[model samples]
Target: MVTAFDEALTCLKDEKIRITPQRIAILEFLTEVQTHPTAEEVYQAIEKRFPGISVATVYNNLKRFTELGFLKEMNYASASSRYDFSLKPHYHVICESCGKVADFYYPKLDDVEVAAAQLTNYTVKSHRLEIYGICPNCQQVEGE
Candidate 1:
């Protein structure tokens, strides 16, 4: 059985990108974290293990991973951009109250893209959709 980690590593190998320490730690963090963190958060998590790794290193590796189709970059308004490694078809739900991000998958949206392409008679390469609302924790806190 091929795990997500295995698939990611395989992609790196296929892309001929060097498997450096920083890249390993970065990929590990992205594979382990579901929170979708910025490069700063990624650096903070791995800095103890990689004392010499810089935030710039994290950003550069992330950019390479994205270019190689191993991940996606999400820009949340004015905040530092976060990286997503879910590596599947889905959209994002952003919490307005606490700035949390979560994945949401809707298979029907695939057809929406086809419909759009037919209507415009133009090729639709891709799309991004983010739904913002108060998250459950925030709602519960306000209820209390």
Candidate 2:
């Protein structure tokens, strides 16, 4: 499997985004965390290892990566936004109790995309899907 860091570098090159150490660190953190981290969370983690990097840099890089189609920005019912490095057609299962997230892959989405393309006059560029529910842990805790 291609490592997330390598994927990020390739994405940067493809989008003609400058590849700097700070950007790489931000990308690496996004890849490793896989928790759909917030900008503040990313900044705090990167700050510990990288003193000179700023919170603004983290936010900017996240936006650039999203434009490059390498990362997806997710919004919950809560106030804050989070970032995910996985760009493929997949859905998210979010835990309501603890706020954990899991990625779900659905092959049927390709068919759905085709149907949507035929139904709409406008081009269907992309789609986002997320399901919110209580996780197993939360269920177990509630059972107690």
Candidate 3:
């Protein structure tokens, strides 16, 4: 698996854009923390390691990576946006009680994508499916 850390290093010499230490730090943090953290979380974690790195730099680098198809931005009823490295089409299940997020994979979604493309005639580039509700742990806790 090509991690964002490795990707950052590999793209250093190959990417059309210039790479900075700040960018590398941001990518590495995102790659290491797979919880789909927000920009603030990433900034806070990386700032201690890369002193003087501003939150704006992290935000910009995230935007650049997403534009380059190296990362993805997701919003889940949170105050800030979340990011993910998964490039493939998959779904997400969010726990309403605790705000926990988990990935859901379904290979058969390709058929649905094709159907959406035909119906909209817009050439579906991508799609997102999020199922939101209380999770098992939360349900169990509430039951008790």
Candidate 4:
């Protein structure tokens, strides 16, 4: 089966981007993770596998990937931007306490976009919805 890593490599090849060991490791790491990670977090995770790898490399590749639409860059006012690998339409629920992000899908929101376009007579390209509250883990810790 063609995995997400394979597909990403194919896309990179089509774009004429050089495929290096570091790049491959980065792509594989991102594909396997559901947790939205910051550039620093990504660096910390992969640095063990690739000794001497610089954080700048991770940041640059992440920026390139985001520009190529391989992933989405989610920025929060309270913290550093996080990278999300999933491209499907969905909203996020953020943990205000720990800054964790989780995805949720609601098909009805698509209709809201259509209604908005109709009401304003303007083209709606996209939208973002973020619901913030303490996550379960944080709540448990608080209770304890």
Q: How accurate is candidate 1 locally (lDDT)?
A: 0.87
* Candidate 2 structure quality by residue, lDDT tens digits, 1-144: 888678879878887878888887887788788588889999998898889888888888888888877788888986678888887668989988877788899887767767888888658877777799998999999999
Question: Per-model C-alpha lDDT, please?
Answer: 0.87, 0.83, 0.80, 0.91
lDDT of 2 at 62: 88
Badly placed stretches (over 4 Å) of model 3 are 1-4, 118-122, 136-144
Predicted structure with the largest TM-score when compared to the true one: 4
- Candidate 1 ranges with C-alpha deviation above 4 Å: 141-144
In the order shown, what is each candidate's alpha-carbon RMSD?
1.8, 2.6, 2.6, 1.1
Report RMSD for candidate 2.
Answer: 2.6
Model 3, span 14-113: residue lDDT tens: 7777777777777777777757788898999989988898888888888978877778889778667788877666788888897777888988876887
Alpha-carbon shift of residue 10 in model 1 (angstroms) = 2.5
TM agreement with the true structure for every prediction: 0.88, 0.78, 0.79, 0.95
Ranking by lDDT: 4, 1, 2, 3
Lowest lDDT 10-mer window, candidate 4? Answer: 2-11
Candidate 4 has a TM-score of 0.95
lDDT score, candidate 2, position 94: 90
Q: lDDT score, residue 129, model 4? A: 93
> Clashes in candidate 4: how many?
0
Q: Taking the candidates one at a time, how many backbone clashes does each contain?
A: 0, 0, 0, 0
Model 4, residue 68: displacement in angstroms?
0.9
